[model samples]
Structures are given as structure tokens and as C-alpha cells.
Target: MASSSSSSSLKFTVRRCQPQLVPPAIPTPREVKPLSDIDDQEALRTHLPVIQIYRKQASMAEKDPVQVIRQALSQTLVFYYPFAGRLREGPHRKLMVDCTGEGVMFIEADADVTLDQFGDSLQPPFPCFHELLYDVPGTQEITNAPLLLVQVTRLKCGGFILAIRLNHTMCDGPGFKQFMSAWAEMARGATKPSIAPVWRRELLMARDPPRITCNHREFEQVQDTLPSSDQNLVQRSFFFGPLDIAALRRLIPQHLQHCTTFDLITACLWRCRTKALQIEADEDVRMMCIVNGRGRFNPPLPVGYYGNAFAYPAAVTTAGKLCRNPFGYAVELINKVKGEMTEEYLQSVADLMVMKGRCLFTTARSYMVSHLARLNLKEVDFGWGDAVYGGGAKAGAGRFLGVSYFCSAKNGKGEEGIIFPICLPAEAMERFAQEFNLMLGNKSQPQTSSATFIMSTL
Candidate 1:
């Protein structure tokens, strides 16, 4: 009897190897199928072009800057030869172009910079993803599709700012980081990379050619219909010390019955965002959390899967109810949404991609802006030292603001907080900051009620 009991207990423990969580089933408009007659080989032959321009150091003059840049572009193309074959798809398998072809000009400004100055510096950011590709005359149709743009600005103080505008389709934060590392290696003149680029498509390929699964149909949404203007948006950086984050983590298990640190933090932000916006309970408020699908799949993603390896898993709550709920309750909602991030769900999405074929482009255009926030930026460091400050998605883009938090390695600050670029109405921005500070225990003293909120500049 004792031996039997022990055997039963061991089996039970093995079954719980990371609780089985699956995404909630959402209904899809229709079932789509891949084109039977299309040539798959021809489809995969395209490349994601890259453009870059380097500013020569002062005291060094080039008679023909354009000629010099042309040469540099040719050399960079050779350096990118290995990666040329990888970026052939639209977004996930999509290519990335180096967009520094036009000579990058330098601007001298005061030590103190304003938001407008920064914005001005990145004028006419890459219009589309294809534009980042090489400037081929007839291939202009393909190369001019500018999805990502990068600007490496040399400051008068001897520092450089590498600003990149990435199309959401290419890759999420992690994918971008991988590409950057590769680019850096090329820039440093390394014959071979410390980290070899992985481009094994078969490993990422779906089980069989027509692997049609019902789950794939539900998550498909058109991306282009997303709102384009977020002019009223505002961005602010917040710091949560190690002790504070640890305290929150400890309190989480007690408050939210079942959840992780990521869920709790997201819930806290979602609640605060709705409260500050004065959104009503009946209206749906969503928090889109990005899930990295690299190692999550069953067979696992290839090392060189450079395309978009991130998916948006969303949780929604009404404004009134969210504000009234405890932080833990919100955390549970996040957990529920995260639970759905399974290998089946990711493969379902891939299967959908294969089926939709041409229609996929139209679908991507419609559902782009659904109030999503990504949390993995904290892990992005170019080795120039962990990013002291990092953020993207310029203000005035969407109703749902995206905030990315980075982990601070310096000073052992365990998972340092995020730098949020919020797109809220002007009036709501002030209140959002107040609630944000309150979460961090930085509220004003009882003696000064007026001091509870302080407005921040863009």
C-alpha cells in the first residue's frame, strides 16, 4: 500500500509540469485556405532590403559624400549577404532593409533637447517596410515598401543616437535585438559572428502543407483599420527600485489568487490607465501583452527565426469594474489571457497564415491598433551597456498605448520598471501620472492635496 501511494503521488506531480494553459477560443469571420497552385519556391526567394548612412567624423572631409555613401552601401550589402535570404516574408518571415542610403546629415543643438527636436531629427521616417530595402530601379516596387527606418545621429558631444523605426510586422523587440547584434558584428568587421544567424525554415514550417485547424480562423483580424493618429499621446519613464518590485511580487500571491509578476504589473497598469481616462464600466478596455513565441512551440522555433516571433495576447475589463477591483483580481484576468499562449495556438496562427495567402495582407491592415502593451523591451541591450533609456512608438498613434519595460542589470535592480509611451487625451495624461505615482507609493503628503499631481512635459 505504501509503494502504491508513492507511485500515485509521483504521477500526479508529473502531470502538473507547468500547469496546462490554453488561449480562450474567439470566433473568426470565415475559414480561409491556401492557394493550391501558387509557386512556394518563388514566394520564398524575396529579401528584406536594408539601407544605412554613416556621418564621417568632423575634420575629415569627403569631396563626394554621395559617392562615398554609395560605396559604403555596396560594402554593407556584401556584409549582409548571409541575412539576405532570411527576410523574404511579409512580417514574420518579412525582410528588413538598411535605410541609411541617403547621406545622414548632422545637426548641432544645445545640450538640453526637446521632444520636437528629436522628432524633427527623424523627419520622414521610413514610409514603409519595403523602403528599407536596397534602391533597385525596377525593383523599386518591392524595395520602396519602407517598413523600418533607422537613423544613426552623431551628437556634437561625441555621442551617437541610433534611432530605428520598425514596422510592427517584421519582428517584435526580441527579433529586432537579434538583428541589431548581427548588424553590430558586421559594423565591427567580424569575419564570423559570435552568434550564428539561424535560418532553418523547415523547423518552423507547419506540420504538413494543408494543416488546417479551426483554431487558426478565430484569431485572424485585419490590421490596417487601426487608428493612425495619437497626437495627444504622452510618454513618461518610471523607476521602481528592487525593494519596491520585490514587495509587489511578495504581495501578489496573496492578493491575486493565481498569477505571475508579469500579470500583476500589467493588471496594475490596465486598471490605472482606465481610471485615469475616466472610462466607464460598460465600455471594453483591453491590455494587449506581447508573448514571445520563440521557445514556446512544441517542436520549438529555430535559432534563426528572425521574423515576428511575438503575438499580442489581450485581456479586457470595463473601466468602472477595473477601478473597483483589487489588483489581484486584475492579475487573474491577465493570467487567464496568458494561459492561452500555447503551442497549439501559435501553430494555429501559422496555419492561418498559410491558408489566407493573398488575403493575409488585407487582414493585417485592418486590426493594427487594439490597445496593446509589450513588456520585453527591458531585456533589449546592445551591450553598449544596458539601455539607460529606451522607448518607441511615437506619441499620437493609437487609443491603446504600448509600454515596454526593461530589466536594469546595473546596481542589481531586479526587473527595473518600464518606460511607457501613453496615447491618452491631453486632460487624462495628468491624472494617469498621478495614479501611476500612487502605484509606486510616490503620492503627495496629506498636508498638500494639490501636490498630489504634477504635470510632466512631453
Candidate 2:
């Protein structure tokens, strides 16, 4: 018998129902090409692990959903062809997508548990969540890995969890959302996507001369090499309802120009995560933000450019200063870093990465944030009314991969709230929960300024 804490107690079992490999409708002109280091970097951004749940309801089509989704994906891949390709070895020991028209792996799984068993508080980095996602077991590298692998697990209650594992370099969060939405649309009988994908890799290609034209602080290489780290971290979900969000925003002064929801939550997270970790007073801290570069450009990326159009913009600070200071100061620091993510700066960042010939991001003393608050979860319908849950699967893996995500979900009143997920040390998590509850429960005090003391029960 499994232990009480074991996910086995949940009665989850994943077995291959059938081999479902769906390829594009058309044959691709055979071509083998080397992905530019920038493109290569994006391609290997992640195992691109994602897990979403959609409860079976009367609103869904009466037809077979597996077949419907499979057909839709097959048709969608005709336009988004790169997904059907597999990664292969390149000359420099780097990776490249071998554009051989191989289909994506689609598996059907069954679990004895019911969706109701999960209740409404479903979240990620769950104990058995890792088992739900499909990947090459025991390996994290994407080389020679299938570009896409999806597993659909049917629950006892008839609802299902759709787990998608893709190569991160294939698309950014926004781009992936675009592809999935179109796939959903095709499932609804659309001939083609409303906004056809634009696959012009050259838009992000390195320049002919590969020159560093402008200042690029984001790409500057670190002079010191940090030692290895592996903190036994656990992921948890933190939800902030409308009122809680408003209260947080109120904490920041309104007169501050860039004082938006993004800055408000970022301030809360940065401060709380820092204090939770109990970093030294002088220890460096930074919030690495993934900013979409599409709009920052003059002729913004075409509507359907389902490729990486985002840049990592980080805000650096010290742990003691971030936690000790008022929330307004953190917001200001965030806004300043945000203001620099202009078109000119984005171009320079590209040039700098091109000069370095590698795609890397800030690692040490950094807490990254990916705000998916704007993702329209309702549109991800595969003939169902809407997905019961649609958001990020795992924030990330390991301590060095410090990441926090702010996502959205529809509530009973058709309203949206942010779902922030993070993984921290067990002891830190205890402190974090106490500190967060204190901040949210302090409704009696007016959020005057950061200087005002906020008491905590912990």
C-alpha cells in the first residue's frame, strides 16, 4: 500500500491507450539546416512542459474528443510545421531541428481518480504532477527529442488533463498560446487558423556583420563563476482575488506613473520571496522579467509570428533593501527596469546575444516572473465550453531556475484573479505563507506609503 502522502493514494495511473502520431497534412520539402545560436537558445529554452485540465461536461461536443483534437492538431501542424520535426546534432555539438516530416507523439492515458477528488484548489508542482507530464524519462536535454509530445489522461469523473511537452525554443508563452488557440479553433471546424502563423526565422537572425551596436547590460557576461546548487524545493500556488489585488495596488502610491498591476504584484513577490529565503543583508537579488518584444518594435512582429518574440529584462537589488524598504520603492525599481525595455534596447540586447554567440539569462540571486494574467483561458475550448483549468504546468525546476508566474482564471462571477506559483525551501514556505496571510488580512490599515509599518503575526 502507498503511503498517505504518496500520490499513489490519489489512484492515478497513466497507460498508453494507443499510438497516436499526427503529422502535417502536406509533405515538407526535405531540408537540413543549422539553427542560429539565438534560435537554438530559444529552441532549448525549456522542455516546454505544460499541463492543463478540462473537465468533461454537457457543453462539449457529443463526438469523440480524442479524434477531434487529433484531427485538429494534424491540420494545425500543416501550417505550424516545425513542431512535426525532431531535434538533431549540429556541427558544434549544439542542437538543430532536423526538418524531417515526422509526426508528434500523442498518447492517451487513464487515471482512476475523479476531477472532483482534486477539488477547486488544483495547482502545480503537485507531488504526482511530474508523473502526469510526458518526457524522456531521466533526461532534461531536448537534443534528438521529439519537438512535441502530448498526453491526455481521462479521469474517473470523465474530465481529462491535457499534458503538452514541447521544445521551448519552438515558441514563447504567447506563441504557444497562439498555436493552442488555433488548434482549439480547428477542433471547432475551422478550415484554417484565423490568424495564419508567420514563420520568418530571419526576423531574429544574427546580423551579417554581427556587430555590437549599442549598450547591452542584459547580455554582459559575469566575471565570476558561481558554485553548483540544488535546493530540495517544492512548488505551491498562491491566489490573489480581486480584492486582494486591489489592496496590493493600493499599497503602491497612485501618482507613480508606471504603477500598474504588473508592478504591484511584482513588488509583493520580490519582497516576500526575498524575505522568505532569508538571504543575507548584502546578498544580491534580482527579478528577471520576460517582456514581449513584439510591440516594442516599430513594425511589430506579424500577428501570427508563433516564435520567440520576448526578451528577459531583469531588475537587480539587495535582499535586505528589497524586504526592508516600502513597497513603493520596489515598484519604482520595477517600473524603471520595465521602462528600459524599449525597441532600441531590445535590438541592442539581440546584438549583444549575437556577439556572445549564446542564449543565456541571469541565474544567480535572480527570481524570474512570467505574467500570464492576460491569457484568455476561455478561448482554449476544444469544443468544450471552456477549460476547467488552463495555465502554466510547472513554474520551473531546481533552485537556480528561480521562476514565479502570475496567471489568470475565471471565477464564479466571470471575474479574473491572479494565480502565482512558486517553489521554495520547506522552511521558507512556512514563513512565506505567514507573511502573505498577514499582508492580505491587514484590511484595517490604509496603504499610505512603504514607510508605514505592517505588522505580521509570524
Candidate 3:
């Protein structure tokens, strides 16, 4: 129960069959394939769970989702053979796939509940999320474990929920999406995927004499300024619609009006979160922006190259400067980090990873945000059309080590917008909501001069 509130009291029992490994449809080559330096980073050696809910379609009323997906997954593994292998660690803690053709873990389940019973809002944190995709005990490790775990829970309403727990070391969000899309194509009777899978991870390998070119502030060690207690932390999702976005945009200067939606909203969240925590004004705070490097390269990585190709370029500033400064101040810091997403910067990161022994991103008084609203995960269809809800199973609550996601979702009123979840102590979460609501409701722009002193005390 990582849910934000206890109001989600709806409960149901699910009957699950024995878990089994589904190997590739045909025998594949057996060899050792090393992962890119970026892929073996300690920060990515964990599993990430994603859920997609599909409603029953009248045209495919008699089709069995479990069987279709099971068959499709086996066919998919033949091409994406790395997923059918197990991760192995070598000297200096480097990771590589053993190409064992051992296959992935799959489970079939039937839940005594309908899609509508989950409530009007299909957003996370979903009730009984863990049951939707059980960890299966020893399968949670990074090395010598199934690269992917999938559970297809058929609902009483003829709809089925597709839950997948993928090892982050294998691929990123976009990479995972590409794999799923190909699997869906197979389920739809495609003999082969439209786009072929490519394994040129060596392209992201570190240079012989690794060079640290740029300032890697994202990995800098710092002090944790907030209260040490992790208990009483609660997670909640907030919706920002067109009107809400308009109000937030009004807070920034007219010159920054053209800033992307992610820049605007993320800046606002960082400010509001800092204010709510009541952190010391002199302490430094950071906002780690996850930038995708696929398009940043000179010629770009190959299509269907499913690997970790992202970086967390951080923006650092003192709490006093951040909370008291004009709204554009935060936006400017974010833009600067995003602008640094070049081929050289990514190569520099690979060098840094190898040099630093693959350290985790700094979380000292920092908030991390990833924009997943545009991933079009909702469009993934396994013959039933779009999913009613498709994305991370849970938003906050340390599911992503305090990283919150901006997902595309429709509110209970059917208004489509961006929904993101934040985790904070109970009292801090209350204050955060108040501060955010005030900003959203205020039509006038903030006066930096007069509000500077007043904002720091918030």
C-alpha cells in the first residue's frame, strides 16, 4: 500500500497460476554481450514496474489476452534476445548479458474485479499494485535474474491488465516502449517487427583515456538539509490542466512564456516543494532534470537501439535564491541544463561513470522529475486499442527513489492534462498543496521585489 490515501478501500482477490519461464520461440545464439558503461551504472541496477489497462473490445470478445501475449512474448524474445538472457557482473562491477536463452518470467492471473471498480480516475497510485505484478521473491535481484517479469491479470469485465517489471539496466523508458510496441505488433499477427532491433551499445562506451569534459554537478556529494525522518512520508498526485498551465505561465516573465511545458511546471514544483519543506534559506537545493540523449548526438543513435541514453543534468541554487527569486530564475536554470545535452556531454557522462565507479545521483535537498506524458504509452494496443491507463504503477512514495513523474492522464471530470505525484512528510505535503493551489488560483504575476522576503518564510 504505497497509496496516498486510505480511501481506495476497494478490494479483490486474484487467482494466479504457477509462474513459468517463456523462452524464445526459436533457438538463438548463445554468447556473452557486454552492456554499455551507461547501462551498468549502479543507479540503474533495479527493476521498474509499468502497468497498462486494456478494456474489452467487442470485435475481439472471444480472444484470450494471456495466450496471445504469451505467444507474442516468445516470438519477441527471438529478436530481442538480450531480454531472454541473464545479467552477469564481471571485474570492477561491470555488467553483461550471458545470452543464456533462459527466457523471461510470465504469470497468468484472474482478478474478481472490473475496471470501473478501480474508480473514475485511472491514475496511480493504483489499489493493490503489488498484487498486480508480484515480485516473485528471488527474481528481484539485478544479476542472474529474469530481465523482465510480466503478469496478465484478466478482469471480470473481460478487460485485462498487463503489468511488466523490467530491469532498468536493460533499457530506458523509450527503449522499453519500443520493445512493447514490437511485441504488440507480433500479437497483431505481424511475422516480424516493422523496425529491426539493433545492439550497438558500444557506441556509448567510454573512451580509452576517459575525459571528464563538463561540470558534473549532478553527481556532486552534498549534505541532506531536510529532516532526517523518512517516516510519515505520503504520496499524492496533482493535475495541471490548460487553465492551470496558463496561470503558472502568468507567473513567469513574458520573455520566458515560450518555455516548454516541462520547464514551466517543473520550475513551479521545485519552488513550491522547497517552500513547503521550510528548509534553511542558506542550504543548497537541486533539481535533477532527466535529459534524453537519443537526439542529442551528431548523427543520432540507430533506430530500435534500446539502451540507457539519458543523463541527469542538475541545476543547483541556494534555497533563499530559489524560493525568493522570480519564477523565471528556476526556469532559466533548467533550460541551461537541458541546453547542455550534446553528444560531448553524454560522452563525458560515460567517462564520469567509469571514473567514479558508477555512483548514484545526489538526493540532498533535491527533487527529480521525468516527463513521460509524451511517451505515448497509452497508445500501445494489444488488439484491444489504447489502454485506459498506461504508465508507472506508482507515482511517488520512493518507488523511484523520490523521483516524481509527469504522466499524461485525464481527471475524474474527463479533463485531459498532466498528472504528477509528489512524496513528502505529512505536514510538508499539506503545506505544498496550499502553496501550489495559491499559485494556480492567483491570476496576477508575482512581484519579486516585495515578495522576495515574504516567499522565503513560506
Candidate 4:
């Protein structure tokens, strides 16, 4: 794509807007410590970086979105004030919020561009991804940090993009959506939040004497080194219409037909990603699927608990076997691990980390995918009409070989489907696209032998 095409660097001017602090009367909780497993001992890593794109509110075109959102955010922060706090570097990579209500970084920018410039593509590296998101100033190393940053960019045609850059550890998808929902409701004049925010992480803390109940590979204490991926990366978006996703489901065995929308799509992506990279036969390839810890918790955490309740349960296998196996093999592997994300599994994870004593995540020969379909982004109205299009912006900010997020979108013909913003090495991306298309194109021919189908595409 058009995303990386040097079609004139996206031009924009940013006049740093006034910083917004937590409402004066809002109460701030005392600072909390990081989980004992601090990869901080090894590297200064920040939370998973994320951004969401929202089109301008047509009816409120003449209204001051900045003023509206700022005021609303301030009010919303009264209930979710921790987001206004700043992160303090503890030991290297580990961080704890100061909870002093320092406030979030806010910016206002203008571009001599129109939403049309993006031409239906929402992958990042588009003109605004850089201008609309903020990276902390100073050593440019992980030392400088902020809890949240919001950018409102006004386009020339009276349209605007609401870009949000926030730390992942502050909340999971539901928690973040709750915060945004509260802000939106406040902007629309809600006297109170729809859901009260809660912070009871201690309830789910590791048990004394650390009970171990799961045999997960993650529960072991081998102290394995994290994997590393290539530094040269590019992002692109792929759309799978309702029909395309259904076709993928049909590719698997009949008994496995109940595969989830995420499972079906990710299996395709994992295979294509592997083929694109052309890893050696003996090399190991891994896919880390994010699992929600909220449901897995015993007596599940409060529906309103605003904290990190996500886990990356991985599925690993050699590249040779991955490419050679039937499509059902990958489907079974993905579903199997996803099924293991239970309360027991989480307890074992807490206990294992307490014993091994380190936060370990890898960046090499790996791919991580998350589907935000539950965010129901299209239904998220903020006085402005529902977003023309909105989802995660693919910022290549971390060491992961590939980072992908999926969300619902209306294809060109207005058919319902999902848009996946994917980031991978440039060359790998080309192979990825070809493989993805080939797989979809083969759905009409269901009888093709699995080996024949995979090899012919390769």
C-alpha cells in the first residue's frame, strides 16, 4: 500500500495545546507497585502502545471538539483519575503510576489534508499516525513517560480525526472502552458515568505459598531468553468481508466448523505470515494470542475493574510443520490454548512468575494478534455520528516482529467485515498479501488437497 507510499509526507502543524489535569476535587489513589515480575531488570519497555482513529462528528462540525472532549475527559477523569497520573520508572522496564494527578498530555493539530487523502485505507504510517500521536520528549529512551495522550486533528474539509495514544497496562480493552464511553457520555451531558470504575487488583493477587495448578509451559522457570525480530518493519491493513471470513471457516474440517471469528481469521494470518517470512524448516514460530483475564478469574473481577486483565497465551510449532499441516491443525492449536485461559491458568501464571521472578515476553520470530470486535466501535456515538471508520492505528513502536489488531469495518460495497491493521517486514508483507489472497480465492474449491493447496501458493 498506499499507507507506506511516499505520496508526499503527510503535512501537519502541531501547536502544543494546554495540558489537561484531573478535575480539582477528584481523589487520587496512592501509588501502587508493579507486579514482582519486572522485565525492567533487563530492558526499559513501556506498555503496549495503542491508537484509535475516529472521524469528525458531522453534526458537531461547528462545535469545538477539543473543548468538548477536554471538558468531558476532565469530568470522566474524576471517576477514572489514575489515567491522569504519570508513570515513574522503578527498576528499568518496570513502572508504577505516581497517582498525583499530574494530568494527561493533550495536543491540537491541523493538516492541509482531507480524510479523502487516506482513500479508504486505515493502516498507520498514513500522514496522521505520527502527527496525531505523541511520544514523550527527553532521552527518547523509555525513561520519559506519560499515562495518556490525546490528539484531535482537524482536516481541511471540516472533518477531524480523534486519535488516542495510551498505555496498555492502565486498562484492558473493556476498561479502555469504558473510559471512552464515559467521556463520550459526559460530552453529551451525562451527570454520571454509565459504569462506575473499580480498582481491586489485590483480590486477584497471588495466593500466599503460591498454589500451582496449571502445567502450562509458562508456569515453568527455565528463564528462557526473549526472541528478537527484525528492526525494519512496515504496516498494512487487510479487509476480510463477511463472506471471506465464512469461507475461511469452511476451509477447516466439518467437526471444527464452530471456530470463532478470531480463530478462523488468525489461523489464516499465522500461516500466511509464516509463508511470507520463509523461515527455515527447523526454526520455531510462535503466535501469542491475547486472552482476557477478567472472565478467567475466579468469581471474575468486578465488571468495572480498571486494570491490566489481559494475557498472551502463545501457540508454538516449527515453521515446516506449520506450513505442511492441514488448516485444521492450526485451528486446533489456536483453540486449544485459548481454551486454557482460565482462573486456574492465571493463578499458576502468578505463582510461576513469583517463583521464576521475571516478566518475560519475546520479540523474535513471533506474531501477536488481537481482535477488538467487541469494542463495538461502530456503535460508539459521541454526539458526532458513529465513526465513518475507526480502529487501532498500526504504529511500529515496539520490538514484536508483527503486531495486528482487528475491528469491524464496512467494505467498499458497504458489506460488513473486519479490518486488520498488520505490521511486518516489508518483504514479508508482500508474501503475506499474496498468501492471504490465495487462501481466500481457494474457498470456492474446497476439495483441493491441503498439501497441494499450501504448496501451490508458496
Q: Find the candidate with the highest lDDT and give its number.
A: 3
Q: Which stretches of candidate 1 lie over 4 Å from their true place?
A: 1-143, 146-148, 200-231, 255-260, 353-387, 390-417, 443-458
Model 2 scores a TM of 0.87
TM-score for each of the candidates: 0.58, 0.87, 0.93, 0.84
Off by over 4 Å in 3: 1-8, 396-400, 442-458
Summed over model 4, clashes come to 3
Model 4 score (lDDT):
0.64
- For candidate 3, the 10 contiguous residues with the lowest summed lDDT are 449-458
Which one is best on TM-score?
A: 3
Task: Flag the better candidate by TM-score, 1 or 2.
Answer: 2
lDDT of 3 by residue, 117-188 (tens): 777436665546667887687898899999999999999999999999989999988888889999999999
List candidate 4 stretches off by more than 4 Å.
1-58, 89-95, 136-144, 218-231, 395-397, 442-458
Tens digit of per-residue lDDT, candidate 4, span 365-458: 6677877776866555667767776666653334443667777777656777777766656667678878888889843211111111011110
Residue-level error in angstroms, candidate 4, position 108: 1.7
What's the TM for model 1?
0.58
Higher-lDDT candidate of 1 and 4: 4
Q: Give the range of the ten consecutive residues with the poorest summed lDDT in model 1.
A: 1-10
The global C-alpha lDDT for each of the candidates, from Candidate 1 onward, is: 0.40, 0.67, 0.82, 0.64
Question: What tens digits encode model 2's per-residue C-alpha lDDT throughout 379-446?
Answer: 58887667766777656633234777676764434456777667666667767777776666754221
Rank by lDDT, descending? 3, 2, 4, 1
Count of clashing residue pairs in every prediction = 44, 2, 0, 3
Candidate 2 C-alpha RMSD relative to the actual structure: 6.1
